[model samples]
Target: MFTLGTYQVHFLTFWCFLKVKRKDRWRNGSKKKFQSQVDRETEFLDVQESDQKLNFKLKGPEGEIQQGTCRYLIGAGGAHSAVRKSLGLKFEGGDYNNEFMLGDVHVKSPQRMKGLHAFFTKEGILAFFPFDDSGNFRVIYGDFKNFDAAKKDLTLEELQFKVDQVGPKGIVLSDPSWLSRFRIHHRMAPCFQMGSIFLAGDAAHIHSPIGGQGMNTGIQDALSLCFKIYLNLRRGAPFELLKGYEQERLPIAKDVLRATDLATQFALSNSLSTRMVKKWLLPFLIEHTPLQKKMAETISQLAISRRDQKIRSNLKIQYP
Candidate 1:
């Protein structure tokens, strides 16, 4: 848990679960105002277009279509957007093959477990985060492919079982607010910009939640693109100026994806080799100040560079 000013903040390292009073969750009226603004700004347009160059028909949700010459397009629909049907963007990546269950529960315990706690069991990774003024806990559990099979609305007995499995037994809960199933995917768009259209956020990259980099990376993507676009618009640059967005962002996304994939693999590994590595080698490395400092620098993102030559050099150092 992290503290800022008068309010206390909790960090759930195991999974992402955030809870606040249903009313106080957002600033007094922020939710309503935000929703109203979203409702007003959102327009679901059905665009149908004939891509004469690709010899394809493009249709949107409402069946409205546009027919025109093909120039350039950017796909920012995110990981869920179908490549073939939507933007014809190729998505190539692997799934984690593990399942994670998360929930929000109200508890009466005085001993609050704060920070990101992980329980590495024979079954999988079970994690918990604390939320709300009433000591509600956000729980994440399971690591096997069958993890979702265990995700039915958890009965009180079932919830107790999970708590017992992850932490010291005898902890009790009074209420559960939310529950859901999730899987990890390590994927990035093969290319960020094809012609004119560019991909950002989940559309450009997807990875395990291990390091909380998903949103950060997406924000970086937005910032990077905004800078480029602003410069291009100010200078009346050609559309090709957008290509640098892809070239610069794609490799960073790929590097993040690779690092996250390794983290997930480490978390899920149970083999004798990994057990030895984790139980012995990992502790030693983490205890060393130099190694720890390097890791800290990497996670802080201060180590990443955007200069083309510097990027190439860092890639060689990290990946090679």
Candidate 2:
């Protein structure tokens, strides 16, 4: 499922844009069945937001300068977002010491299809995730100390060795497709909005990818923000309605950071506390139906909503 997940995320964010741009031009000079609806313009050079308006300085494909204005700005850019930086938003937290290595390899496993396996060894943490339904797997191993030692390119033989050392007996990995190493970081912009400007995805917050919520969280931000903006524009709602976007999302980002950090710490450490929880507490908790249901909803982001927030959706919004 790793490849499938990766493809879905990419298609949603990037491929969709490319397809829109190339729509009718690709097949022939003839007209297309469906006309592109979005007015996409690229080469954004600078942006400034203030007094309920956004001023953008753009560079065209031919390198000509242009300027435009809008009532709102949404920064979907990844980490190092220029919009967040220009607005002087604070991003708390830094990179953790742990480093993780991942590889896509053909694996022989007796494990059930789509089963996810995680192993905490003295060497660190090892995890196996199905890459697809075709018998390939994504293997990952990492910790703080080994993260530094694992900087260099890891050979296929070395990857197999590491898997053999940490993985369950009888499973073998070979025919590698890709390998890479990365570090975990937990960063959050305390506020998801500043004046008429807003941030989403990695721009608003980023955390350990343990639960696979990184992309999903960003997409959620976009969808939630868009929904609110639609109400403000089409339904004659006040501009202040946009504030709920940040109010709803920032807290979720904080919660995901906390959850992922706890999971990462527990998996990478062999402390007495971790060992006790891993050996006994974890299994017991997993058996609890209510806790499992809660976890399932959280992981799926289905539990995310503003129903509990004191701010009501129909509250009168005063524009600044």
Candidate 3:
């Protein structure tokens, strides 16, 4: 009946934090009742799906392998999802032209790094996001900087050197707490549903960190899918009710990918990238662009499918 596959797939995810944050509106003691249902500090080792149900193999904090099962599976495991691999779905996208570096460290500069700042230098495009008044900030740069650096251990001296490569010169960086080189791109799974199992969050889609929408989108995926699951699983709704999970959420994921793909072009751009970024959004990409943190705004303004007008109810699920 479901179009996903004979073996629909999903990995394990602990929704404790996302759940606790929304527990305020839960009626009565159900929150406490369900609180015990969450598995904290547990990691999934493997999964086996059979006859429209999923069996989980997990490692506990003490390193014991525990087993479990459920009527449904929602894959939220993220980019390297073992669940997705089990489903045999293609991620279907490629990396941007140049490799990138992102790090949060101490920055010293006369320029106010209070908000997102994009600087276009002769070498490439560089941006700064101030983490706090303590001079700690996140720096991002791209433009063929990929080399042995990708292989050798990254060092503070090397990070500063690359910062120099993208020169506007007044800034000094140090106290590197975290630094890593990676490639950004636009990617998505063609299918988000596979029969009794479904995919949500980063397991369903991923894109550039251009507007800080990765986690938000994944949260959206979870909330959207959860309600449908409740309706069918608890409310005794039609077996067909599950079909709407992918129909409703998949298009929204596609919209996010399209929006971020365009934005990533600027993120990875060297020449017109700077000017284009400034042309559309002077200092930041959030307030102006169509990449709305809430899909309600994205649908209304960004021309996402009209079906997406259904406002995302807060994590509150008033199950009937």
Best model number under TM-score? 2
Predicted candidate 3 versus true structure: per-residue lDDT over 68-113, tens digit per residue: 9988877777898777878889998777656667777789878655
Clashes of each: 11, 2, 1
The digit string of per-residue lDDT tens for model 2 on 1-320 reads: 01101001111111111121244476344324436333246555678865667898767667789899988788877888877877788888978787788787778867543555566666666766665556677778885374575357877777778777766656777787678778889999878887778899998998887877887899888877876786677766667778888877888889999999988776777677776676667656766778767777777787876531333335443221
Model 2 weakest 10-residue run by lDDT: 1-10
lDDT for model 3 comes to 0.65
At residue 209, candidate 1 shows an lDDT of 75
Clashes of 2: 2
Estimate the overall C-alpha local distance difference test score of candidate 2. 0.70
The TM-scores of all predictions, comma-separated, are 0.68, 0.77, 0.70
Q: lDDT of all the models against the reference?
A: 0.60, 0.70, 0.65
Weakest lDDT window of 10 consecutive positions for candidate 1 = 1-10
- Ten contiguous residues with the weakest lDDT in model 3: 3-12
Best to worst by lDDT, what's the order? 2, 3, 1
Better of 2 and 3 by TM-score: 2
**lDDT: which is higher, 1 or 3?**
3
lDDT of each residue in 1-320, candidate 1, tens digit only: 11011111222223333454553655458757656432222322222344423222345446555343433343445677543225566678988777776667765544655654455555566655555445677777655454455455555566567666555556786676666667778877677764445678888789987766887688678766765565456545445556777777888888889888898898787676765665567546655777766666665555876543443343332211
